[model samples]
Target: MVNILEFIIRSKALYTTWIYYKPNRLLFDVGEGISAALGNKIYSIEKLFITHSHVDHIAGLWGFINTRNNAMGSREKDLEIYYPKGSKNIEDYLNFIKKMNKYLRFKLYIKEVEHGDIIPLKNNRCLKIFKTRHTPGEKSIGFQIIEKRKRLKPEYRNFSGKEIKEIILENGKDEVLEEYEKKIITISGDSLPISPDIIEDSDTLVHECTFIKESDRKLRNHTSLDEIKKLLTYISPKRVILYHISSRYNRLINKAEKELTESFKNIEFHIVHPEEISII
Candidate 1:
Protein backbone atom coordinates (compact mmCIF):
# COMPACT_ATOMS: atom_id res chain seq x y z
CA MET A 1 0.00 0.00 0.00
CA VAL A 2 1.07 3.54 -0.67
CA ASN A 3 2.02 5.61 2.34
CA ILE A 4 -0.27 8.47 3.23
CA LEU A 5 1.10 11.91 2.38
CA GLU A 6 -0.86 14.02 4.87
CA PHE A 7 -2.83 13.50 8.08
CA ILE A 8 -4.46 15.65 10.78
CA ILE A 9 -3.81 15.28 14.49
CA ARG A 10 -6.44 17.78 15.61
CA SER A 11 -8.79 19.82 13.42
CA LYS A 12 -10.93 21.93 15.69
CA ALA A 13 -11.55 25.62 15.12
CA LEU A 14 -9.45 26.58 18.10
CA TYR A 15 -6.58 24.17 17.47
CA THR A 16 -5.05 22.14 14.67
CA THR A 17 -2.03 19.98 13.81
CA TRP A 18 -1.23 18.56 10.38
CA ILE A 19 1.47 16.10 9.37
CA TYR A 20 2.90 16.01 5.87
CA TYR A 21 5.65 13.78 4.54
CA LYS A 22 7.06 11.78 1.70
CA PRO A 23 10.78 11.77 2.37
CA ASN A 24 10.80 14.36 5.13
CA ARG A 25 8.11 14.70 7.78
CA LEU A 26 6.75 18.03 9.06
CA LEU A 27 4.39 19.13 11.82
CA PHE A 28 2.35 22.24 11.09
CA ASP A 29 0.70 24.36 13.82
CA VAL A 30 1.56 22.46 17.00
CA GLY A 31 -1.56 22.95 19.07
CA GLU A 32 -2.23 21.47 22.52
CA GLY A 33 -1.60 17.75 23.21
CA ILE A 34 0.21 17.31 19.91
CA SER A 35 3.29 15.84 21.57
CA ALA A 36 1.27 13.27 23.52
CA ALA A 37 -0.55 12.29 20.34
CA LEU A 38 2.82 11.68 18.69
CA GLY A 39 3.70 9.26 21.49
CA ASN A 40 6.86 11.08 22.68
CA LYS A 41 8.64 10.52 19.42
CA ILE A 42 10.98 13.37 18.53
CA TYR A 43 12.72 12.05 15.43
CA SER A 44 9.66 12.18 13.20
CA ILE A 45 9.45 15.94 13.24
CA GLU A 46 12.10 17.28 10.89
CA LYS A 47 10.60 20.75 10.75
CA LEU A 48 7.75 22.71 12.28
CA PHE A 49 6.01 25.58 10.50
CA ILE A 50 3.85 27.98 12.44
CA THR A 51 1.09 29.89 10.65
CA HIS A 52 0.51 32.36 13.44
CA SER A 53 1.19 32.91 17.13
CA HIS A 54 -2.33 32.30 18.44
CA VAL A 55 -2.43 30.44 21.75
CA ASP A 56 -4.46 27.65 20.17
CA HIS A 57 -1.93 27.36 17.37
CA ILE A 58 1.17 27.26 19.54
CA ALA A 59 0.08 25.74 22.84
CA GLY A 60 2.08 22.57 22.15
CA LEU A 61 5.44 24.25 21.75
CA TRP A 62 6.32 23.72 25.38
CA GLY A 63 5.41 20.05 25.22
CA PHE A 64 7.36 19.57 22.03
CA ILE A 65 10.42 21.26 23.46
CA ASN A 66 10.28 19.20 26.62
CA THR A 67 9.90 16.01 24.66
CA ARG A 68 12.86 16.85 22.47
CA ASN A 69 14.95 17.60 25.55
CA ASN A 70 14.10 14.23 27.06
CA ALA A 71 15.30 12.57 23.85
CA MET A 72 18.35 14.77 23.37
CA GLY A 73 21.02 12.10 23.24
CA SER A 74 18.94 9.85 21.00
CA ARG A 75 17.95 12.46 18.45
CA GLU A 76 20.24 12.60 15.40
CA LYS A 77 19.35 16.12 14.27
CA ASP A 78 18.29 19.47 15.69
CA LEU A 79 14.70 20.65 15.44
CA GLU A 80 14.04 23.58 13.09
CA ILE A 81 11.09 25.90 13.46
CA TYR A 82 9.92 28.60 11.05
CA TYR A 83 7.43 31.33 11.77
CA PRO A 84 6.47 34.80 10.56
CA LYS A 85 8.89 37.62 11.33
CA GLY A 86 8.02 40.34 13.88
CA SER A 87 4.63 38.87 14.74
CA LYS A 88 3.13 39.00 18.18
CA ASN A 89 4.99 38.42 21.47
CA ILE A 90 6.57 35.22 20.20
CA GLU A 91 10.09 36.27 21.11
CA ASP A 92 9.10 37.11 24.65
CA TYR A 93 7.02 33.98 24.97
CA LEU A 94 9.81 31.77 23.70
CA ASN A 95 12.32 33.48 25.95
CA PHE A 96 10.14 32.83 28.97
CA ILE A 97 9.70 29.20 28.02
CA LYS A 98 13.42 28.78 27.51
CA LYS A 99 14.17 30.35 30.87
CA MET A 100 11.73 27.97 32.54
CA ASN A 101 13.20 24.97 30.72
CA LYS A 102 16.81 26.05 31.25
CA TYR A 103 18.00 22.51 31.96
CA LEU A 104 16.68 21.08 28.69
CA ARG A 105 19.43 19.27 26.71
CA PHE A 106 18.42 19.71 23.08
CA LYS A 107 18.80 22.52 20.59
CA LEU A 108 15.83 24.35 19.13
CA TYR A 109 16.65 26.47 16.11
CA ILE A 110 13.99 29.07 15.45
CA LYS A 111 13.98 30.99 12.20
CA GLU A 112 11.73 33.88 11.22
CA VAL A 113 10.33 33.84 7.70
CA GLU A 114 8.67 36.49 5.56
CA HIS A 115 6.42 36.53 2.55
CA GLY A 116 7.80 35.23 -0.80
CA ASP A 117 10.58 33.36 0.95
CA ILE A 118 11.36 29.82 -0.23
CA ILE A 119 12.36 27.20 2.31
CA PRO A 120 14.23 24.31 0.80
CA LEU A 121 13.00 20.85 1.61
CA LYS A 122 14.49 17.50 0.72
CA ASN A 123 14.78 16.28 -2.88
CA ASN A 124 15.11 19.70 -4.52
CA ARG A 125 11.61 20.75 -3.54
CA CYS A 126 10.87 24.02 -1.75
CA LEU A 127 8.07 25.44 0.37
CA LYS A 128 7.10 28.97 -0.58
CA ILE A 129 5.69 31.13 2.17
CA PHE A 130 3.20 33.92 1.48
CA LYS A 131 1.47 36.45 3.70
CA THR A 132 -2.25 36.33 4.52
CA ARG A 133 -4.60 38.92 5.99
CA HIS A 134 -5.39 38.05 9.58
CA THR A 135 -5.02 39.52 13.06
CA PRO A 136 -2.24 42.09 13.24
CA GLY A 137 -0.80 40.51 16.36
CA GLU A 138 0.12 37.39 14.38
CA LYS A 139 1.19 37.84 10.82
CA SER A 140 -0.61 34.94 9.20
CA ILE A 141 0.98 33.08 6.30
CA GLY A 142 0.36 30.26 3.86
CA PHE A 143 2.68 27.68 2.30
CA GLN A 144 3.12 26.10 -1.13
CA ILE A 145 5.46 23.23 -1.95
CA ILE A 146 7.10 23.53 -5.34
CA GLU A 147 9.22 21.09 -7.33
CA LYS A 148 11.81 22.07 -9.90
CA ARG A 149 11.57 20.34 -13.28
CA LYS A 150 14.28 19.69 -15.87
CA ARG A 151 13.65 18.35 -19.35
CA LEU A 152 15.49 18.25 -22.65
CA LYS A 153 15.13 21.39 -24.73
CA PRO A 154 12.68 21.18 -27.61
CA GLU A 155 15.54 21.46 -30.15
CA TYR A 156 17.55 18.78 -28.37
CA ARG A 157 14.80 16.30 -27.58
CA ASN A 158 16.52 13.50 -29.50
CA PHE A 159 19.98 14.04 -27.99
CA SER A 160 21.32 11.51 -25.49
CA GLY A 161 22.89 12.57 -22.21
CA LYS A 162 26.36 11.88 -23.52
CA GLU A 163 25.64 13.78 -26.75
CA ILE A 164 24.24 16.75 -24.87
CA LYS A 165 27.32 16.87 -22.67
CA GLU A 166 29.60 16.65 -25.71
CA ILE A 167 27.72 19.44 -27.49
CA ILE A 168 28.04 21.70 -24.42
CA LEU A 169 31.77 20.92 -24.12
CA GLU A 170 32.34 21.55 -27.86
CA ASN A 171 30.24 24.72 -28.06
CA GLY A 172 31.18 26.01 -24.58
CA LYS A 173 27.50 26.75 -24.01
CA ASP A 174 24.19 25.10 -23.16
CA GLU A 175 20.51 25.61 -23.91
CA VAL A 176 19.02 24.45 -20.61
CA LEU A 177 17.22 26.70 -18.12
CA GLU A 178 15.46 25.86 -14.91
CA GLU A 179 11.68 25.50 -14.85
CA TYR A 180 9.42 25.28 -11.83
CA GLU A 181 6.13 23.45 -11.48
CA LYS A 182 4.45 23.18 -8.13
CA LYS A 183 1.91 20.93 -6.46
CA ILE A 184 0.73 23.64 -4.11
CA ILE A 185 -1.00 22.76 -0.86
CA THR A 186 -2.09 25.96 0.84
CA ILE A 187 -3.33 26.43 4.41
CA SER A 188 -5.13 29.58 5.51
CA GLY A 189 -5.01 29.37 9.28
CA ASP A 190 -7.70 31.32 11.11
CA SER A 191 -8.09 34.16 8.69
CA LEU A 192 -10.74 36.25 7.03
CA PRO A 193 -11.19 35.99 3.30
CA ILE A 194 -7.63 35.46 2.07
CA SER A 195 -6.25 37.34 -0.87
CA PRO A 196 -6.63 35.54 -4.20
CA ASP A 197 -2.89 35.77 -4.81
CA ILE A 198 -2.17 33.76 -1.68
CA ILE A 199 -3.95 30.60 -2.92
CA GLU A 200 -3.99 30.87 -6.69
CA ASP A 201 -4.00 27.52 -8.54
CA SER A 202 -3.30 25.53 -5.43
CA ASP A 203 -3.77 21.78 -5.68
CA THR A 204 -5.23 21.63 -2.20
CA LEU A 205 -6.52 24.49 -0.06
CA VAL A 206 -7.06 23.87 3.66
CA HIS A 207 -9.22 26.84 4.66
CA GLU A 208 -11.16 27.71 7.79
CA CYS A 209 -14.92 28.18 7.73
CA THR A 210 -15.88 29.29 11.21
CA PHE A 211 -19.35 30.31 10.14
CA ILE A 212 -21.38 28.34 7.66
CA LYS A 213 -23.68 31.21 6.72
CA GLU A 214 -23.38 34.88 5.95
CA SER A 215 -23.66 37.19 8.97
CA ASP A 216 -24.30 40.91 9.17
CA ARG A 217 -22.19 41.10 12.31
CA LYS A 218 -19.14 43.30 11.95
CA LEU A 219 -16.54 41.15 10.26
CA ARG A 220 -14.11 39.57 12.65
CA ASN A 221 -10.97 37.62 11.75
CA HIS A 222 -12.77 34.52 10.54
CA THR A 223 -14.22 33.27 7.28
CA SER A 224 -17.88 32.54 6.49
CA LEU A 225 -19.39 30.01 4.10
CA ASP A 226 -20.12 32.70 1.50
CA GLU A 227 -16.54 33.90 1.61
CA ILE A 228 -15.29 30.36 1.26
CA LYS A 229 -17.43 29.92 -1.84
CA LYS A 230 -15.95 33.02 -3.38
CA LEU A 231 -12.47 31.74 -2.53
CA LEU A 232 -13.22 28.46 -4.26
CA THR A 233 -14.42 30.27 -7.33
CA TYR A 234 -11.23 32.28 -7.44
CA ILE A 235 -8.59 29.66 -6.59
CA SER A 236 -10.24 26.58 -8.13
CA PRO A 237 -8.08 24.13 -6.24
CA LYS A 238 -8.38 20.42 -6.97
CA ARG A 239 -9.37 19.67 -3.38
CA VAL A 240 -10.84 22.03 -0.80
CA ILE A 241 -10.86 20.92 2.83
CA LEU A 242 -13.03 23.09 5.09
CA TYR A 243 -11.96 23.05 8.71
CA HIS A 244 -11.86 25.09 11.92
CA ILE A 245 -15.61 25.18 12.51
CA SER A 246 -16.73 26.82 15.72
CA SER A 247 -17.95 24.64 18.60
CA ARG A 248 -21.39 26.17 18.19
CA TYR A 249 -21.50 24.74 14.65
CA ASN A 250 -20.84 21.17 15.71
CA ARG A 251 -24.35 20.15 14.79
CA LEU A 252 -24.16 21.86 11.41
CA ILE A 253 -21.37 19.78 9.83
CA ASN A 254 -23.79 17.69 7.81
CA LYS A 255 -25.71 20.72 6.65
CA ALA A 256 -22.53 22.51 5.65
CA GLU A 257 -21.32 19.44 3.80
CA LYS A 258 -24.57 19.13 1.87
CA GLU A 259 -24.66 22.77 0.89
CA LEU A 260 -21.01 22.91 -0.15
CA THR A 261 -21.25 19.69 -2.15
CA GLU A 262 -24.33 20.81 -4.00
CA SER A 263 -22.91 24.22 -4.73
CA PHE A 264 -19.40 23.19 -5.76
CA LYS A 265 -19.97 19.91 -7.54
CA ASN A 266 -16.74 20.07 -9.51
CA ILE A 267 -14.48 20.31 -6.49
CA GLU A 268 -13.66 17.63 -3.94
CA PHE A 269 -15.02 18.91 -0.63
CA HIS A 270 -14.16 17.55 2.79
CA ILE A 271 -15.37 18.84 6.13
CA VAL A 272 -12.58 17.85 8.48
CA HIS A 273 -13.07 17.63 12.25
CA PRO A 274 -10.69 17.41 15.16
CA GLU A 275 -8.80 14.07 15.18
CA GLU A 276 -9.70 13.40 11.56
CA ILE A 277 -6.75 12.86 9.16
CA SER A 278 -6.45 13.48 5.42
CA ILE A 279 -3.73 12.25 3.06
CA ILE A 280 -3.30 14.48 0.02
Candidate 2:
Protein backbone atom coordinates (compact mmCIF):
# COMPACT_ATOMS: atom_id res chain seq x y z
CA MET A 1 0.00 0.00 0.00
CA VAL A 2 1.11 3.55 -0.72
CA ASN A 3 1.60 5.70 2.38
CA ILE A 4 0.85 9.39 1.94
CA LEU A 5 -0.08 12.05 4.48
CA GLU A 6 -1.74 14.94 2.68
CA PHE A 7 -2.92 18.00 4.62
CA ILE A 8 -4.68 21.10 3.27
CA ILE A 9 -5.79 24.28 5.04
CA ARG A 10 -7.26 27.47 3.70
CA SER A 11 -8.86 30.54 5.25
CA LYS A 12 -11.71 31.63 3.01
CA ALA A 13 -10.90 32.99 -0.44
CA LEU A 14 -8.57 35.85 0.45
CA TYR A 15 -6.68 34.48 3.43
CA THR A 16 -4.29 31.61 2.65
CA THR A 17 -3.83 28.26 0.87
CA TRP A 18 -1.28 25.62 1.67
CA ILE A 19 -0.98 21.85 1.19
CA TYR A 20 1.59 19.67 2.90
CA TYR A 21 2.33 16.25 1.44
CA LYS A 22 4.32 14.28 4.01
CA PRO A 23 5.24 11.22 1.98
CA ASN A 24 7.49 13.22 -0.31
CA ARG A 25 8.34 15.85 2.29
CA LEU A 26 7.03 18.58 0.00
CA LEU A 27 4.76 21.60 0.45
CA PHE A 28 2.57 23.16 -2.22
CA ASP A 29 1.87 26.92 -2.11
CA VAL A 30 3.21 28.25 1.21
CA GLY A 31 0.52 30.70 2.17
CA GLU A 32 0.42 32.62 5.45
CA GLY A 33 0.42 30.83 8.83
CA ILE A 34 1.87 27.66 7.31
CA SER A 35 4.65 27.32 9.85
CA ALA A 36 2.27 27.85 12.74
CA ALA A 37 -0.19 25.40 11.27
CA LEU A 38 2.35 22.65 10.54
CA GLY A 39 4.57 23.44 13.58
CA ASN A 40 7.52 21.05 13.66
CA LYS A 41 6.25 19.16 10.62
CA ILE A 42 7.77 21.95 8.55
CA TYR A 43 11.21 20.48 9.21
CA SER A 44 10.35 17.39 7.21
CA ILE A 45 9.66 19.41 4.08
CA GLU A 46 12.53 19.41 1.58
CA LYS A 47 10.86 21.06 -1.38
CA LEU A 48 8.12 23.66 -2.05
CA PHE A 49 6.21 24.33 -5.26
CA ILE A 50 4.66 27.78 -5.66
CA THR A 51 1.81 27.71 -8.20
CA HIS A 52 1.61 31.47 -8.50
CA SER A 53 2.74 34.75 -7.02
CA HIS A 54 -0.57 35.67 -5.48
CA VAL A 55 -0.31 36.99 -1.93
CA ASP A 56 -2.62 34.34 -0.53
CA HIS A 57 -0.52 31.58 -2.06
CA ILE A 58 2.94 32.84 -1.05
CA ALA A 59 2.57 34.93 2.08
CA GLY A 60 4.04 32.23 4.33
CA LEU A 61 7.52 32.43 2.86
CA TRP A 62 8.50 35.16 5.30
CA GLY A 63 7.81 33.14 8.44
CA PHE A 64 8.74 29.78 6.93
CA ILE A 65 12.27 30.87 6.12
CA ASN A 66 12.78 32.30 9.57
CA THR A 67 11.32 29.26 11.30
CA ARG A 68 13.56 26.86 9.43
CA ASN A 69 16.61 28.95 10.19
CA ASN A 70 16.06 29.25 13.95
CA ALA A 71 13.97 26.21 14.82
CA MET A 72 15.43 23.33 16.80
CA GLY A 73 16.01 20.58 14.29
CA SER A 74 18.34 19.39 11.61
CA ARG A 75 19.16 22.53 9.64
CA GLU A 76 21.43 20.84 7.12
CA LYS A 77 18.78 19.65 4.74
CA ASP A 78 18.44 21.69 1.52
CA LEU A 79 15.04 23.26 0.79
CA GLU A 80 14.33 23.84 -2.86
CA ILE A 81 11.54 26.26 -3.89
CA TYR A 82 10.14 26.18 -7.40
CA TYR A 83 7.94 28.86 -9.02
CA PRO A 84 6.67 29.80 -12.42
CA LYS A 85 9.35 31.21 -14.70
CA GLY A 86 7.87 34.58 -15.51
CA SER A 87 6.17 35.61 -12.29
CA LYS A 88 7.78 38.89 -11.42
CA ASN A 89 5.95 39.20 -8.14
CA ILE A 90 7.31 35.90 -6.89
CA GLU A 91 10.80 36.76 -8.05
CA ASP A 92 10.74 40.05 -6.23
CA TYR A 93 9.52 38.46 -3.04
CA LEU A 94 12.15 35.74 -3.18
CA ASN A 95 14.84 38.33 -3.65
CA PHE A 96 13.48 40.32 -0.74
CA ILE A 97 13.56 37.19 1.38
CA LYS A 98 17.17 36.59 0.48
CA LYS A 99 18.18 40.04 1.61
CA MET A 100 16.18 39.94 4.84
CA ASN A 101 17.29 36.46 5.87
CA LYS A 102 20.97 36.35 5.13
CA TYR A 103 23.49 33.86 6.54
CA LEU A 104 21.03 31.02 6.92
CA ARG A 105 21.94 27.66 8.43
CA PHE A 106 20.37 25.49 5.74
CA LYS A 107 20.88 25.82 2.01
CA LEU A 108 17.92 27.42 0.18
CA TYR A 109 17.53 27.06 -3.56
CA ILE A 110 14.92 28.81 -5.68
CA LYS A 111 14.21 27.77 -9.26
CA GLU A 112 11.95 29.20 -11.96
CA VAL A 113 10.09 26.75 -14.17
CA GLU A 114 7.74 26.92 -17.14
CA HIS A 115 5.18 24.59 -18.64
CA GLY A 116 6.26 21.00 -19.40
CA ASP A 117 9.14 21.16 -16.93
CA ILE A 118 9.73 17.89 -15.06
CA ILE A 119 11.19 18.00 -11.56
CA PRO A 120 12.55 14.63 -10.45
CA LEU A 121 12.15 13.49 -6.88
CA LYS A 122 13.36 10.60 -4.78
CA ASN A 123 12.12 7.02 -5.42
CA ASN A 124 11.37 7.46 -9.10
CA ARG A 125 8.77 10.16 -8.57
CA CYS A 126 8.51 13.45 -10.47
CA LEU A 127 6.48 16.67 -10.60
CA LYS A 128 5.06 17.67 -13.98
CA ILE A 129 4.22 21.34 -14.57
CA PHE A 130 1.45 22.70 -16.76
CA LYS A 131 0.08 26.13 -17.53
CA THR A 132 -3.09 27.36 -15.78
CA ARG A 133 -5.42 30.31 -16.13
CA HIS A 134 -5.48 32.34 -12.97
CA THR A 135 -4.91 36.04 -13.65
CA PRO A 136 -5.01 37.17 -17.22
CA GLY A 137 -1.44 38.55 -17.31
CA GLU A 138 0.21 36.80 -14.41
CA LYS A 139 1.88 33.46 -14.92
CA SER A 140 0.14 30.65 -13.09
CA ILE A 141 0.48 26.88 -13.28
CA GLY A 142 -0.58 23.51 -11.89
CA PHE A 143 1.36 20.45 -10.81
CA GLN A 144 0.95 16.68 -11.07
CA ILE A 145 2.88 14.02 -9.21
CA ILE A 146 3.89 11.06 -11.42
CA GLU A 147 5.35 7.81 -10.22
CA LYS A 148 7.36 5.65 -12.58
CA ARG A 149 6.37 2.02 -12.28
CA LYS A 150 7.28 -1.17 -14.04
CA ARG A 151 4.46 -3.29 -15.33
CA LEU A 152 4.20 -6.49 -17.31
CA LYS A 153 3.44 -5.90 -20.97
CA PRO A 154 0.18 -7.05 -22.55
CA GLU A 155 1.90 -9.89 -24.38
CA TYR A 156 3.22 -11.31 -21.11
CA ARG A 157 0.02 -10.81 -19.08
CA ASN A 158 -1.50 -14.16 -20.12
CA PHE A 159 1.60 -16.14 -19.12
CA SER A 160 1.50 -18.22 -15.95
CA GLY A 161 3.71 -17.41 -12.97
CA LYS A 162 6.13 -20.20 -13.77
CA GLU A 163 6.10 -19.31 -17.45
CA ILE A 164 6.78 -15.67 -16.62
CA LYS A 165 9.67 -16.64 -14.39
CA GLU A 166 11.12 -18.82 -17.13
CA ILE A 167 10.63 -16.14 -19.73
CA ILE A 168 12.25 -13.54 -17.48
CA LEU A 169 15.20 -15.83 -16.87
CA GLU A 170 15.73 -16.34 -20.60
CA ASN A 171 14.79 -13.01 -22.17
CA GLY A 172 15.50 -10.77 -19.15
CA LYS A 173 12.85 -8.95 -17.08
CA ASP A 174 13.32 -5.74 -19.03
CA GLU A 175 12.16 -7.43 -22.21
CA VAL A 176 8.90 -8.70 -20.70
CA LEU A 177 8.09 -5.61 -18.63
CA GLU A 178 7.77 -1.95 -19.50
CA GLU A 179 8.03 1.18 -17.43
CA TYR A 180 4.95 3.45 -17.31
CA GLU A 181 3.91 6.58 -15.47
CA LYS A 182 1.07 6.63 -12.96
CA LYS A 183 -0.28 9.96 -11.80
CA ILE A 184 -0.50 9.92 -8.04
CA ILE A 185 -1.83 13.42 -7.30
CA THR A 186 -2.77 16.64 -9.09
CA ILE A 187 -3.11 20.22 -7.74
CA SER A 188 -4.89 22.89 -9.74
CA GLY A 189 -3.71 26.01 -7.93
CA ASP A 190 -6.36 28.72 -7.91
CA SER A 191 -7.24 28.20 -11.53
CA LEU A 192 -10.30 29.48 -13.38
CA PRO A 193 -10.92 26.25 -15.25
CA ILE A 194 -8.44 23.45 -15.89
CA SER A 195 -8.24 20.93 -18.69
CA PRO A 196 -9.28 17.33 -18.08
CA ASP A 197 -6.01 16.01 -19.52
CA ILE A 198 -4.08 17.38 -16.55
CA ILE A 199 -5.94 15.49 -13.82
CA GLU A 200 -8.01 12.86 -15.62
CA ASP A 201 -6.24 9.69 -14.48
CA SER A 202 -4.81 10.96 -11.24
CA ASP A 203 -5.54 9.00 -8.08
CA THR A 204 -6.14 12.21 -6.13
CA LEU A 205 -7.12 15.63 -7.52
CA VAL A 206 -7.21 18.88 -5.52
CA HIS A 207 -9.04 21.70 -7.29
CA GLU A 208 -10.20 25.13 -6.26
CA CYS A 209 -13.93 25.82 -5.98
CA THR A 210 -14.04 29.45 -5.03
CA PHE A 211 -17.75 29.96 -5.56
CA ILE A 212 -20.63 27.61 -5.02
CA LYS A 213 -22.98 29.55 -7.25
CA GLU A 214 -22.44 31.02 -10.68
CA SER A 215 -23.80 34.44 -9.61
CA ASP A 216 -21.02 34.66 -6.99
CA ARG A 217 -18.32 34.13 -9.62
CA LYS A 218 -17.64 37.75 -10.49
CA LEU A 219 -13.88 37.35 -10.83
CA ARG A 220 -12.56 35.92 -14.03
CA ASN A 221 -9.67 34.13 -12.40
CA HIS A 222 -11.56 32.10 -9.82
CA THR A 223 -13.38 28.78 -10.28
CA SER A 224 -16.97 27.93 -9.47
CA LEU A 225 -18.91 24.77 -8.64
CA ASP A 226 -20.60 24.96 -12.02
CA GLU A 227 -17.24 24.72 -13.78
CA ILE A 228 -16.11 21.91 -11.50
CA LYS A 229 -19.18 19.86 -12.41
CA LYS A 230 -18.40 20.39 -16.06
CA LEU A 231 -14.83 19.14 -15.57
CA LEU A 232 -16.06 16.09 -13.63
CA THR A 233 -18.13 14.97 -16.59
CA TYR A 234 -15.04 14.32 -18.74
CA ILE A 235 -12.67 13.11 -16.02
CA SER A 236 -13.02 10.63 -13.20
CA PRO A 237 -10.52 10.75 -10.37
CA LYS A 238 -10.33 8.33 -7.46
CA ARG A 239 -10.59 11.28 -5.07
CA VAL A 240 -11.69 14.87 -5.65
CA ILE A 241 -10.77 17.52 -3.08
CA LEU A 242 -12.09 21.10 -3.15
CA TYR A 243 -10.23 24.03 -1.63
CA HIS A 244 -9.82 27.85 -1.80
CA ILE A 245 -13.49 28.33 -1.12
CA SER A 246 -14.94 31.80 -0.54
CA SER A 247 -16.08 32.73 2.96
CA ARG A 248 -19.29 34.20 1.62
CA TYR A 249 -20.75 30.71 1.45
CA ASN A 250 -19.95 29.92 5.06
CA ARG A 251 -23.59 29.96 6.17
CA LEU A 252 -24.61 27.69 3.33
CA ILE A 253 -21.68 25.25 3.63
CA ASN A 254 -23.65 22.44 5.22
CA LYS A 255 -26.42 22.64 2.68
CA ALA A 256 -23.99 22.88 -0.21
CA GLU A 257 -22.01 19.93 1.10
CA LYS A 258 -25.11 17.77 1.39
CA GLU A 259 -26.26 18.78 -2.05
CA LEU A 260 -22.90 18.04 -3.63
CA THR A 261 -22.71 14.75 -1.75
CA GLU A 262 -25.97 13.66 -3.32
CA SER A 263 -25.03 14.90 -6.76
CA PHE A 264 -21.63 13.19 -6.91
CA LYS A 265 -22.49 10.01 -5.03
CA ASN A 266 -20.28 7.74 -7.10
CA ILE A 267 -17.00 9.49 -6.26
CA GLU A 268 -15.43 10.61 -3.03
CA PHE A 269 -15.63 14.40 -2.67
CA HIS A 270 -13.79 16.34 0.00
CA ILE A 271 -14.26 20.02 0.83
CA VAL A 272 -11.82 22.15 2.83
CA HIS A 273 -14.03 24.66 4.54
CA PRO A 274 -12.90 28.14 5.48
CA GLU A 275 -10.22 28.19 8.21
CA GLU A 276 -10.28 24.40 8.38
CA ILE A 277 -7.99 21.54 7.48
CA SER A 278 -8.79 18.50 5.34
CA ILE A 279 -6.62 15.41 5.38
CA ILE A 280 -6.71 12.78 2.65
lDDT against true structure, model 2: 0.87
lDDT of each: 0.73, 0.87
TM-scores, all candidates, are: 0.81, 0.95
* Candidate 1 all-Cα RMSD: 3.9
Off by over 4 Å in 2: 1-4
Predicted candidate 2 versus true structure: per-residue lDDT over 1-280, tens digit per residue? 9846566455467889898887788899988988998888888999999999889999999999999888887767789999999889999999999999998998998899999999999889999999999888889999999999999999989889999999889989998999999999889998987888778789888889999889977778989988988888898887888898988887877787777778777777888888577666
TM-score of candidate 2 to 2 decimals: 0.95
Count steric clashes of candidate 2.
0
Q: Per-residue lDDT tens digits of candidate 1, residues 1-280?
A: 9855565546676665544443457777877777766664446777888888888888888877877777544544578889889865677778877987887555678899998898988877788887877775668887777777666567877888888888778764445433556666777777887777767767778787777766732568888888888877776888888877766676778788888888888887888754455445
Measured with C-alpha atoms, the lDDT of residue 92 in candidate 2 is 93
Best by lDDT: 2
Which residue pairs collide in model 1, if any? Answer: 11-274
